[model samples]
Target: MTVTLKDFYADWCGPCKTQDPILEDIQEDWGDRFQVEKVNVDEEQDVANEYQVRSLPTLIVENDDGVVERFVGVTQREDIEGALESAGA
Candidate 1:
């Protein structure tokens, strides 16, 4: 199945900045195993609203079956990895 990591963040959000490196590392490790879509809330309010993202850094893991995991704020590396693994990434 296709797995996707939807990262909802704004440029000015501090926690979002902190989450960036972690996501980058995950991308480096996972490569094409999954896809990461970064949504800038400031520029993409519609998309953010569609996801009902009420926080600065919201991470949503989805597969072909739909959303499997959702996290708010600055999430840990292992937590994200676990989510991806569960989603069949």
Candidate 2:
């Protein structure tokens, strides 16, 4: 199984930039077991609306089974990992 991580952020959001490294680290650590995708709220409003993202830097964790969790703002590595674990990835 694979863990799908969707990071929702706007280009103009500072926190979104701050979240880059954290996501990169997670990607590197998790490798192929996880998939990281970025969605710009402004550019991909349909996706943002579909996921019901209400704020910048929102994170949606899912697996082949579907959505597992929704996190708003910058989330820590451990938290993200915990969510992945919960998703059975």
Using Cα atoms with residue i matched to residue i, what is each candidate's TM-score against the true structure? 0.97, 0.93
Q: Mind giving the per-residue lDDT tens digits that candidate 2 earns over 7-87?
A: 999889998998899889988888887788899888999999999888889999999899999888888989988998899
Q: Give the backbone clash total of model 1.
A: 0
For residues 1-89, write the lDDT of model 1, one tens digit per residue.
99999999988899999999999999999999999999999999999999999997999999999999999999999999999999999
Alpha carbon lDDT of each predicted model: 0.96, 0.89
Evaluate residue 38 in candidate 1 and report its C-alpha lDDT on the 0 to 100 scale.
Answer: 92
